[model samples]
Target: MKLVFVHDGPIFEDKDGQYYEYSYHGLYERYKYLADEITFIMRVYPVEKDTKGTKLPAEIKVINVPNFKSPSSYFLKKRIAEKNIEKQIRETDYAVLRESSCAKIALKYCKKYNKPYIYECVGCIWDGLWNHSLLGKLMAPSSFIIEKKIIKNAPYVYYVTDQFLQRRYPTKGKSIGCSNVVIDKVDESVLKKRLDKISGYHVDNKIKIGTAAALDVRYKGQEYVIKAIKKLVEQGYDLEYYLAGGNRKQSTFLKDLAVSLGVEKRVIFCGSLDAAEMPHFYDSLDIYIQPSKQEGLPRSVIEAMSRGCPVLGTKIAGIPELIEQKCLFKKGSVSAVTNSIVYILHSDLEKISIYNFQKAKKYTKEILADRRRHFYDQFLEEYRY
Candidate 1:
């Protein structure tokens, strides 16, 4: 079978003609058995000097579209992109659409061509856009309405969050909850080391707090954590903050923000780390916080949990499903973040680490792979008939 996979995320191509994507490392591998030939339809850009991502397999085909910088740019390039996407959809045997603006366009062609497709509803478009910026806020409502309608009508839908997304965008057709995050394995030693670190922690020792997310997106809420660090420092608590992910430009912007906020010394920018290096990054941290104002069952939180690092995140989307209610704080509230950190510090850190480690085991690669395969097997069976 020939499959056309569509997503709005940009893919980068190096001078050597190699393609790279930040979050798509093992994603295409899942469909290897389902599709005889796979073509990815996404925006393609030249690789930046400081950019980091997993290299794409040479066997996979890519159909590049313009990387629109804004709504106006998207509009300017819409006609040409639509013509190309329509042709691909018409030629493809099946479609797998990851929720995005580009996916919305592809869906129209899929229907027009009578192509069978599955929808991957990863995050809430409303929260994602509303929390993004002034322009995104203005686009949020209409985009939400469009995406909700898209999901509602999809014959097969897979949501990353168990209940949050399903409830918010209830579908009348067949659906299942499955996270895209796939933990290769959880080492027993990781939990033991975390427990030992927690037990050895002292009030006088500087607590290390870290978050792994792209710095370019403000909705990831790294600034809120920086504010919390400043407040905690004012209260005489020893603390250090580490931020991972982003290009050179985004890093400089954040570094400037840290300097202005008087937490430059406490905040460390680690730039972007490869997938293999992420486990070590989580291990080095005393606490992992996902301060995102928007998310769809954040992979970083689960990765952190696998390393037995105690986590704190906002009480939004699928976050509550991952951690105990006590660890959650209000989104975008610096004071609430400040209080949550203090509460976790005063609570039983060892117990939290153990709980997180055990919870992470549920998301191991073997378990999720089985679920995904079952879904795709059913999809292929239906398509074949």
Candidate 2:
């Protein structure tokens, strides 16, 4: 059977120096392993393929729909994406969507073409937006209505965040847990011994706590990390902070904050790196963190855990699921986050990091493939599609 995945854009969002988009690549990585016959109905855009260029699997197909404009004109562009998407679906056995806009279009195609479609949404976008502005809170009711409609309509509904599903709707989808949690940690090519030795770097030393995400101030909790770093410095902890991802806007703001904290030498702004090369950055960490106020199964957490890095993060949206019993604090509390980091850092975290890596095994590419295939199998068995 043929399967098609729809997305807002073909490439991830790039800020001044940091690239912050997550859901698309994470989902693509997971789904690419599961489905043999697939088509990418994406918003074609320009991107940098490494100097060596990209190598895509033969099972995947690309079909760009130019109707993708900015969020402001989504309705008009959506119609265009939907217009051609319907044509592609005529031969496909199944269609999957990443978010609400795509879900609505996929919903329509399923209704019109008599094809079975699934909503592969990660979590509640409306609630995530509520972290950024009052507008998101205002939009939540409509988002709820639309989410409910999409969930009820789909033959299969898979989510990336279990907390989101449980809080917003009943847990009745085929593969009910967080569908995929991506981390660029396990590259069999690299020597495992290098990553396995976490104690050599962090034990009673001037540790560097790192986080990789777009410099955007709102969603990423960059400010909170900086504030926590300042608090740690005040407590006489010899440490430097690595703020790896940020664009011009975010970098400028953070640079100023670092100077204001008078810890300018301690904070480093290492701009965006190619997605494939992120594993190197993950390997160098003494302590890893992401204090995001809201997240959908953070890929960074998965990556850090893969390197056997003990992650200290906020207990937000889907994050608590992966960091289950790891290290966490109340969301937005710099003091709480600082304490958690200090506690984790003082101990010999090599064994803890090993445990973290072992836990991450459950969400591997092979595991995701099995889950997706079985989800399709169960749905088909229940109703011959």
Candidate 3:
């Protein structure tokens, strides 16, 4: 079977020369084992012109989604490009795909050509833009109409969480269940080196509360963790926080927030590290805190658990379904989030470690990959009509 994946996730450039968006690292790792021939059609933006992917597993194709931005021509050039890509899809069997942005073009072609495709929805874009102030009253209804039309057209739509399933999207066709594809193990040598570097930074017998996420705290709930960190400090606990993320500007804003709380020196902002830096950061921490009210099964929490760092997260969306522990707080409750962190910090590490270790294995890449292979095979067969 010829398997093709289309995604708009961030690209990864490591010391090794691999090329593709590494967001679904676990999924792709598993794809290595499952796909006989895999092609990843991605939007390689201007920023990634010089960068390549990690030292990825073999037998994969990195095909760039054609660019279509000419200010004088408005969207005419982009429209032409989309039409070309759509025609290409019409001529071939593109198995798996993400239903966002330009994939709509390919999806239209797939339907016209009677080719099978899977629509993967990580989140509702309309909800996302609204949450981030990118959505307006006019855009809301338009966004709804657009999403409704595209979703209804899909033969199969997959979501990383249940939010999209229990609501709109997959209005027709098979609404396949989903899971977050993160936490494929990294090179232990690279993992150890990253941790050793972090260890040399600062540690003074304080309970280390660590988090690595995109710097947007409003949606990410990193801000809530900051506020909770402040409360913890007030309670006479020596709190040391290491927040790592991609945006350097967010690091500056968080530093300011920390100063306002008088814990500026207490919070450490390790500017974005490579993908290899993730596992060690998760493992080195005493506790991992995620106060996010909005997310589709965060890879951060999964990685933290996989590395044996007890996690405290809001029981929102698919999280309560995935996390195999009592370490959850009700969404939007500041006090509850704070208390969960304290519980993990004060609890016996041994008991928590055993439970967390067993649960983390449930989200390993191998397991997720096997599930994906089954889903892809079934979807292609079921939707081929």
Candidate 4:
């Protein structure tokens, strides 16, 4: 059987012809179980060097399509993109469409040709676009309506969040909630080490708080955390805010904000760390915060939890699903974030760490892989006949 996986990707090909994407490593291996051959239908971009992304295997075929920059550009190229997408859909035995403009276009062809397809609903288009900028906010309502309709009518659906996305975009067909985050293992020793670190915490010692997210996206809400850090510093708490992730331009913007807030010395930007280095990074933090204005069950939060780090996040999207109510604060509210940080500092750190470590075990690779396999198996069984 053949599978055509369509997404809004600008998957990179380096000078040596190696394919790369930030999160696509080992993905083709997982999908191979359901199909003999797989073709990826998305946008492709050429890069001079590898960008620290997962190198894709050479066997997978990539069909490049136009990447629209704006509404006008999209309208100009829509017909051409649809023609290519339709041709690919007709040629493949099965289809998988991730939520994007390309997916929306592909959906029309899927229904027209009576092809079997599944929708991989990841994030809320409305929240994503609305929080992006003024133009995105203007376009969000109609985009949400269209995506909701597409997801509702999909024959099979898979969501990353346990509850949030399903509620926002309900499907009448078969559906399953399985987070893409797959932890390698949950070690008791790691939790014990975290507990020891927590026990060593003293009021006089400088508290280190950190967030792992790209600096480019303003909606990630790192600025709010910076504001909260300023307030806390004024309250006489010695705090160091570490932000991990890269984007030089946005990093400069954040640095300027810190300087203006008079907390430049307290803010530390630890440029992007390698995947292997993240566990140690999480361990070094006194507290981890995901003060995002938007998210689709953030993998960084789960990663921090796996290391038994006490975590706080905004009450939005799938964040509430991962964090307890007491640890959650209102998104975009500096006061709420400040108060939550204070609460975590005053509360029993060991108990919170234990709870997070136990909660993270639910997303271990061995467990989630089985759930995903079962879902794919069922999908194949129904569609193959």
Expressed as tens digits, the lDDT of each residue in 253-360 for candidate 1 is 778878998999999988778788899999999999999999999999999999999999999999999999999999999999999999998889899999999999
List of clashing residue pairs for candidate 1: none
After superposition, candidate 1 runs with Cα above 4 Å error: 69-76
**Residue-wise C-alpha lDDT for candidate 3, range 257-295, written one tens digit per residue:** 888988878788876655686766776677787776666
lDDT ranking, high to low: 1, 4, 2, 3
Worst 10 residues of 4 by lDDT: 47-56
Instruction: Identify the runs in model 4 with alpha carbons over 4 angstroms from their true place.
Output: 46-51
Positional deviation of residue 336's Cα in model 3 after best superposition, in angstroms: 4.2
**Among all windows of ten consecutive residues in candidate 1, which has the lowest summed lDDT?**
67-76
What lDDT score is found at residue 52 in candidate 2?
A: 17
TM-score of each: 0.97, 0.81, 0.78, 0.92
**Model 4: per-residue Cα lDDT at residue 379:** 88
> Lowest-scoring 10 consecutive residues by lDDT in candidate 3?
46-55
Give residue 225's lDDT in candidate 4 (0 to 100): 93
Q: After superposition, how far is residue 26 of candidate 3 from its true place, in Å?
A: 4.3
RMSD of each: 1.4, 4.6, 5.3, 2.2
Cα error, candidate 3, residue 126 (Å): 4.9
